[model samples]
Target: MNKKLLAGLISALLAHAAHAFDPFQIKDIRVEGIQRTEAGTVFSYLPVKVGDTMNDEKAAAAIKALFATGFFKDVRLEIDGQILVVVLEERPAIASLEFTGLKAFKPEDLKKSLRDVGLAESRIFDRAVVERAEQELKRQYLAQGHYAVQVTTTITPLERNRVGVNFSVNEGDIAKIKQINIIGAGAMSEADLLDLMVLRTSGWLTWYTKNDQYSKQKLSGDLETLRSHYLDRGYLEFNIDSTQVSISPDKQDIYITINLTEGERYTVSSVKLAGQMLLPEEELTKLVQVVPGEVFSREKMADTTKAISERLGNEGYAFANVNAAPELNKEKRQVAFTVFIDPGRRVYVRRINVSGNTRSRDEVIRREMRQVEGAWYDGEKINKSRTRVDRLGYFDEVTVETPAVAGATDQVDMEVKVKEKPTGNIMLGAGFSSAEKFTLSGSVQQQNLFGSGKHIGVQVSTSKSNQVYSLSHTDPYFTVDGVSQGFDIYTRKTDTSTLAVGSFGSDSAGGGVRWGLPIAEDDYLNVGLSIDRTTLKTDANSPLRYRNYVTTFGARSNTLLTTLGWQKDARDSLLVTTKGSLRRAVLEVSLPGSTATYVRATYQHQHFFPLDRRLTLAVNGEVGVASSYGNKDLPFFKNFYAGGIGSVRGFDSGSLGPRDTALNEAIGGDKRLIGNAELLFPVPGMGRDNSMRLSVFMDAGNVWGYDSKFSLGSLRYSGGVALAWNSPMGPLKFSYANPFNKKAEDKVQRLQFQMGSVF
Candidate 1:
């Protein structure tokens, strides 16, 4: 009876399980909340189709797939008797994105950067994506030293299931470099090590170049430089084990510590040459800047090798190799150098090719090249050509390469490549000189004229006492043999005083031409001749002064002057000059068409002294003398005047000596002297590439009549400080001057500045 009852119960359970629930078969599909996403897209993700059996597993998967598209906030799957329903809450579309309080980056640019990360206007919005973008934005700011940056994001829903997102950013103060310290420098002082670093603590000039701001890339470069400085100076075992950068709790201050190991320094004991010299051994030895008695320096050795190679190439050796091997003496702490040299084949330039100049004419570059085809290769010429191209201000970069000519023995091809940059500029300026206060000047200049390697300029200036208009042109390569030519035409009207109680005004127009003849590879002799016609108006308020002045005066005059001068500039840079020039001119002056002659001679000397690695001192002096010969009368405008911006800055224009009662200004005399000295220093917290400088200058000079006594006590003294900016537009300068020894009568000049000044 128990077995029969159990069998009946099992049969009943089997019958219930078999008829429990047939799988629901889908007959139709429907979707809800289809705003941005189409209903078809929702249906495509569904696992159930018409006539297909539906189960709890299939329904859950379909819902998950739809949600994973990131286009729906909520997804629900439902089933009827034979139909499956896909319900989704589509994400709202973005109408637009707005940003506020952004300083470092533009709003439009920020939006564009976000577009790549699946964020843009009219796109479905997701909270997760927005949060990721906000993090990325903050990271970019922090990388640029904005450690305290704040970012906020807000989303507002609109009608039609659209949304608007706004990002409000606060770009706080930039993190500045507070301190830099060197640790574990066993033998070097902390101050000395810090001096070797390019990154430094904040000080003045922080606002200009912003070098005080911290950057990982800049720090890496500075560390490399520091390492090289030590290693090159005989610290062979020097090592920078680690560098630590720490930020303050407030994220405002930054501290850096560099750990270094400096080894002992070594000196050179002996020097020997190991290779055959195309030139004499003595000649090659003279080329090396390093000596046996000096400390062993890798940089000096490298420079010595380069100099030897350059000397060989200059002597028609196209290829040369120079290597230095050091023999160490442990006991003496000294090293001996054995320099090896290899002079390669004496090749000639078979062909010359120029490229990368899209606008410049081929002839323009070819004419400036010192090395010629079919000639023996010259390294000096090649280097000079490169420098000439660089000085043209037309190219961003210029390089020359020599490739061996296939199948041609002792022949190579020269290729010149150049990258062009903008060289034309327009300038409008207003400035004040003691001589011409309240002056206005404007100019338009083109250094590369029509891409033909010529310079053309037009300038106009007006002042209370002077007016000038001029046009000038220069041909860098006037002839095939490297001669230069310059031409200028100018018209001027001036009212100026003379020492002898007379005021002279003149209207003159003239043109002058100059020809440059190459005296040496780096020197030139220039000759110039000019002719001008002048109408002079003179007035005398003092009878005694007029008596001496009227005796040598002329109403109108025509003059012809011929001048010869020479210049040699072989310095490593133009910023430092050590050169001199002697000029002699013979002038013929007359009334409109009269015959008169005068002779003048002038000499100038300039010298540069390097005080240290960071300081340079310059001194310049000039003297001019004039004498009358074969002319009964001297031209009124021919007299000399001094005591202005170019002369003594403290004194008024032409006010260094006695003034003419008849004229309101100082007069030009027959003899003059001028001298200036300057000390240049780098401003702290500014990079050397775009550096700022502070200068203290002293100027002294005087003008006197030919017969008057020349005395040093008569010289006026003025001292002042100046600021210099090496800017893209050129060197911009501002100076504060105290004229006449800083006396109360000598007030300070508040603002004296200029742009695009050559000196």
Candidate 2:
């Protein structure tokens, strides 16, 4: 249609202006002035062929077609004695595009953005398109709060009818919000309302959150939050009338004003159940959160609807619809909500499809699933399955969806998609510290061995005080009933002769077989048995306590060890935990047949409470006790030790225990107690980044020997600040602490750091 319209205009121009001539029959067609366009290409666009009668209309159409190709800047037609001639001047093509002062964005991204706007290298250059490209660059800067951004486009002619385009940008400072005014907020304090918004005036943390920057997207979200805040507080008729954002003359300061009408608060008069009461009305009534005489809350109303929907979903109604219909009385300032539920067709899972397991086997992920195919659709089971798969630690992400089967109303397909991560790790580390002197360690482990959901690891370490070599393997699903089995073999040599501990050395070798039984969701019962032989080595410099033990128990002894443990973990994440509790208890016993018989038990409980979106309160407690059995004494080596990173900071590792007064060396103890409280938050100047966190912590712990009296006053206390980073290699932690009750004999290390694991 555009071609025909252009043709009619061209025909009128030809008749009234130059090239006005009588219709003639063409003998041959010839093209001229085309530098790159082919003659055949021109001929194809021409409506009139060599044999067609040449008229004003056909001539106009031919010229219009050639011009519409966008290849030529100027097109003309002439006749040389009935041999029609077409003349063309091709448009200059873009040879290259370059950007200057591109710090806010990548050059490639800008190039792609220009390409999307029809301005790229090797493409025909149009002045209008270049102008649009300039506007696009400015728009990009504006979105980033760069209101004073300047963009200048330059076109440089090149050889062969080509051009080079350069976009010079000067991105100015980001416009920061200097003030936020909430007009017509009567029920709540304006400051309180602003506190609920993400966008805010410049403050201490704004440098990290960038909440002071003027952003349309942030403003929209803030508005929604403001609305929700009011609605959730019983303001049923709340409305945001207008929002005004203005910038200063220099464009460096932005001011935002939100005008909203906060209607009268309303109370719930009654709550009723209506529509398709598939379940007992009395049972469904328990799901209603709103009660009579209570303030009306949209959050409670929504929760009620969601609960009803999930309950129906558990009954195979996969597409249930639940809504809360509210009736308001302006005179009484009261509202009543009637929860309506629609239970759609009963559906069962037809098939469970697993995808995105590039390295892991299908069954490796499938075995974690609790939702069974051919069973009724159960929302709880499906959610549990997703959580279990995620807890495998083999995938970066796991998602599950149940979509109705095509052409089958009663059936749905369960789609479980997972994004796998590197499940194998190899670490080699060397460190030189004043306390440990020189140490070297290395480990190679494959958590998902050969995509079989098995684990295998080999570890080796050498240091001035200790040397260890170990091998371990685990099959998570040794049995189809979700029982796990593993085995470990290791040899360790400890030389405390030069250290703070009692000057004694010991060499040991051990092997163990362990099994885990899943007692319930998130709970496991572990049992293991192992046998080891140890040879104690001591010299004259050794503490009298250690030498006496060696003389009494003999230099060499063999012991059979057995372990039983129970664990329950309900954390939201294995790493970056913000909520839930982890409780574990383990008991270790040397059997009666062993050279030394003893029982050691330890219990730990750690809980994380989310104070808000950005803060968490974590508290951890641990207790350990050891006792002799069968008329035997507990081995000194088996004594519990506390202090340092995993216990109390500001104290040396294994230094907070009973000490041999003659040698002034800690000898560990049979009783241990530790407690920690921490406030965890994001690292300052790194908003919303979960990869790192900062914590302020208080630690208290102590250890007591078998003959020593356990007293709370003996406990040591410390306060410190710590930083944890989830780096590319592993989790890294650093801490600085000051002991509150430091004794002259106590060993203190004010600063400590470690990598590759969390304390």
Best by lDDT: 2
- Candidate 1's displacement at residue 350, Å, is 4.4
Q: Which ten residues in a row have the lowest lDDT in candidate 2?
A: 1-10
lDDT of 1 by residue, 1-759 (tens): 111111112223445535323456667776766766777776676666677776545555566677678888777555444555565677888899999998899888888878878789988888877988898889789887898999999988899889899999989888888998887776667876676566777767666666677888888988887777776677766788998998888888888888888777788888888888879888888877767777777777888999999998987787898998888887787888899999988988888899999988988888778888989989999888888877778899899999889997688898999998887978786755444556677888999899998999999988777889999998978887878899999999876542222355678888889888887866678878777767666545433343354455545556777777776655555542323222222333222333446666666676667675567786778777666666453443566666545666655555555455434344456677889898877765555542467778988887776568677877667788877766655556667666665333222343466555321
Model 2: residue 555 alpha-carbon error in angstroms = 5.7
lDDT of each: 0.72, 0.88
Top-scoring candidate (TM-score): 2
